[model samples]
Structure formats: structure tokens, C-alpha cells
Target: MKIKLALIVILFGLLTTQAQDKITVAVGTNSTFIETYNKNSWSGNFTLNKAYRLGPTSLKTLKDGVKTSLKWIELNNSYYKTFQKEVCRFKTMEKESFKFHGYVDEFAEEMTMIFYGESDGSFKIEIKPYNSYSIFITFTNLDMLRGFKDLLDGKSANNEIDDIFKK
Candidate 1:
């Protein structure tokens, strides 16, 4: 009986560890972000843009590893699609003077990226979901920034690929 109990405990521990496993990717483009989630069964909000604003009562705190109801308004979109809400697991990461907040969806299928710097820098990005783990992508290069811009603009990847092949 003790041996059986030990086996069950071991199995439960493995499952718990797996549930908390995180996948981090340094995103360069919307396609990369999309592809990452698609291949991993994660969820994201591709329609998110700069015009969207977080609701006043949404995400009221900045504590790490906390779960909260995320609410925001997509200003550029219509009313039906404007106000968005989701249950998310909040996580934080600090690099240099910047702090990034990741809101992973309830089921851990997607992550919404929000960042603010100590010295007047802030931005947000939405990527599809993943499990109860944090997904943070830090932009450390120009290419990543450019790619992200293209993503926000809804640019076609075909043109980018053609340009690359032409070169």
C-alpha cells in the first residue's frame, strides 16, 4: 500500500510540474508569435493594437503571479468588439529599467503583453494563449521591433518573404 501511495504521489508531482512549464519566445513578427501558439495549442488576441486602452478597473494591481479579470477597450474597433474581458494569470518580469506584465488566459492558451518602463516607455501586444505559464518576449534588436510593427499594421508575410528571396 505504501508503494502504491508513493507511485500516486510521484505521478501527481509530475503533472503539477508540467502544468507550470513555461514557453518563452523572442518574437520577431506576428507570424512567429501566431505560429508559436498554433503549434503549442496556446491562445491570443490578434486584433489588439495601440489604440486599445485598459479599462480603469481592469488589472488594478501589479503583483506577480496573480490571477485577475482583465478588461480593456479597443478604441479602433466597434462597440461589439470594443470592451474585452478575460480571466488571466498575471506574471511580471524585470529587465534593465523596464517591467513587463504578461496576462496569460485562464486556461493558459494565450498571453497578452503589457509593459511599462521606469523612464517613460510603455507598450502592449496580444499573443494567443498557453497554459498557466508566463510568456514574455523582450525586444533586444531592431529586427524584432520592425517585425512587430509590421504585425500591428497587418502587413502580409508574403511580401516580406518575396523581398527576402529577391535579396
Candidate 2:
């Protein structure tokens, strides 16, 4: 009986391990930050931009309407260059601080990107506006998106690097 119990325990552990999908990488600012993600959740440390940055451990490809897609958030140089012009709504440029009031559907040509809050229980998102050349954001797989909204509004982060020198 004891042997059977042990075998069952081992099998359960293996199953649980297999059920999780995870990825971790040290990306931007010379790899000073460690980013990680799994299945429906992600987290990372933020440092000012320098030579390079870190990438997420694992993530799904988040695509815009045009299918311009990106997976992990790192000090990815690709974002620095303006993506070639594609079919879209309008040219949006505004000097606004960190204030995420809604979801992605509310955006127009003025804001360039509109956001709206999801009434149904779904996921959460947090964004870090680094600057013109760099931006950082994270979403949650947890049940609610309330607690972390402040993070998107520039409340607190695990690691906030002083990138005054980057400018």
C-alpha cells in the first residue's frame, strides 16, 4: 500500500509539472532585469535602458489588428524602429502620462490606442511607459484585474531603474 501511495504521488507531481508552461530570460539594460512568464501569468524586474535588456521566460504572441505581433517584453531593439506603415485607423500622438482607464477597443486616431475595462471577469494588465523609445507592460492570468491596475498607472514596480542617463 505504501509503495502504491508513493507511486501515485510521483505521478501526480509529474502531471502537475507537465501542466505548467514557463519561460524565463534576462533581457534589457545589459540583461540587468530578469523576466519570466508561465501559462496565463507573467512578472519581471525593470531597469533603465542601457546596452540591452531581458526577455520574458515564456509568453504567447500578442498581436494587434494588423497581425503585427510580439511575444515577450525585453529591451528589444525591434520596437525602437518604427514599424512600416500598415493598414490602420489614424495617426495617434498625445502627451499623456500613465493612465489606463479602459481596454484596447476605445482607442481612436487621437490617442492612437484606446482602452476599455472588461466587464466580465477575465484578465488583468499593467503597463510601464518607459519613454518614447521604450515601453513595458504585463498582464495577469489571475481571476481579477483590479489589484494590478495601479501598476499600469505608474504606482510601483519590483524594480524601477533610474534611466535619467538614457535621454
Candidate 3:
């Protein structure tokens, strides 16, 4: 009985750790963007998450102005850090044009994103594909960017329960 109980506890701990390893971050409240060609837009929260599955991470958004969501542009983990660095560099005006190009095999599409500093000091991400419509995403809150970086770094925002239990 003692050995069984110990094994169960160990298994539970491992499962909890695995569950907490996945990170999800919301961009902001009701933040949405329009596709340039179709002029279709949705009013919903934008989110990014790195799941416990194989392959790359993706940015999620609402689909067709509804509650249903869809993921866009699956990118490899290696590009995330470079993207964060480029955003910082672009903010300082060190680089005139910030761009990232990657091919996502899941969609069989080539994705190109361009970052530009807005006049208000915020930044916009423009997704211009060679064969598809363009997408423009404006970041109004800097905290969302920080949260995204933290998510890519394997940090969880849902630590309040742990903090409460620790205290």
C-alpha cells in the first residue's frame, strides 16, 4: 500500500508539471484585425500558445466573427527569440525595416511578417503573403508583447494558485 501510494504521488507530480509547461497569453481585450483583400474582420481576443504537442507554436484568433477560433502561421521555436529581439531593436529605430520569413508546412504556405513602428510609438505586424491576403495587427498594449515573450520562454501566467498555496 505504501509503495502504491508513493508511485501515485510521483505520477501526479509529473502530470502537474507537464500541464504547467504549456503557456498561453492573450493579446488584449477584443483585439482583432482585418484581412486586407477580403476586408473580413472579427472582434475577439487574440491569443498565442505553445502547447505540449510536437511542431511549432501559433497565433490564434476568432474565426468568421464568431466564438470559434483558428490558429495562424505556425512558426518554429527558434524564430521566437529572434522575433522578440527584432521587436526591441525596431522599437529603438536601430533597424529601418523589421521582417521575418518562414515556411509553414502544416499550411504549405510561406509567411512573411513585417514590423513597423507606428507614429504613436506602438508597433504593427503586417503579414504579407505572396499568394494570400495581407493581415495587419496593431499592438496597443506593450504588456501583451511582454506576456508573449514570457510565454515563449516557458513561463506561465497562471501562477496565482501556486503563490496562494505557497503563502
Measured over all alpha carbons after superposition, the RMSD of each candidate to the real structure, in angstroms, is: 19.2, 20.8, 18.1
Q: What is the lDDT of residue 12 in candidate 2?
A: 8
| Model 1 C-alpha lDDT versus the unseen true structure | 0.26
Candidate 1, 39-88: lDDT as tens digits: 23355323211111111122232112022211222222222332223324
TM-score of each: 0.25, 0.19, 0.32
lDDT tens per residue, model 2, 1-167: 01111000000011123222322222222111212223333444332222112112111111131122122111123333322222122222121210132112233112122121232432223322222323233334321122122222222222332132122
Instruction: Note the Cα lDDT for every prediction shown.
Output: 0.26, 0.22, 0.25
Model number with the top lDDT? 1
* Evaluation by TM-score, superior candidate among 1 and 3: 3
Candidates 1 and 2, the one with greater lDDT: 1
* lDDT of each residue in 2-100, candidate 3, tens digit only: 111100000001122111212222221221112111111274332321111111222231111011100111131222322311211010000111112
Among these predictions, the greatest TM-score belongs to 3
- Candidate 2 has an lDDT of 0.22
Q: Which regions of candidate 3 are displaced past 4 Å?
A: 1-107, 126-131, 134-138, 161-167
Ranking by lDDT: 1, 3, 2
Model 3 residue 144 lDDT score: 38
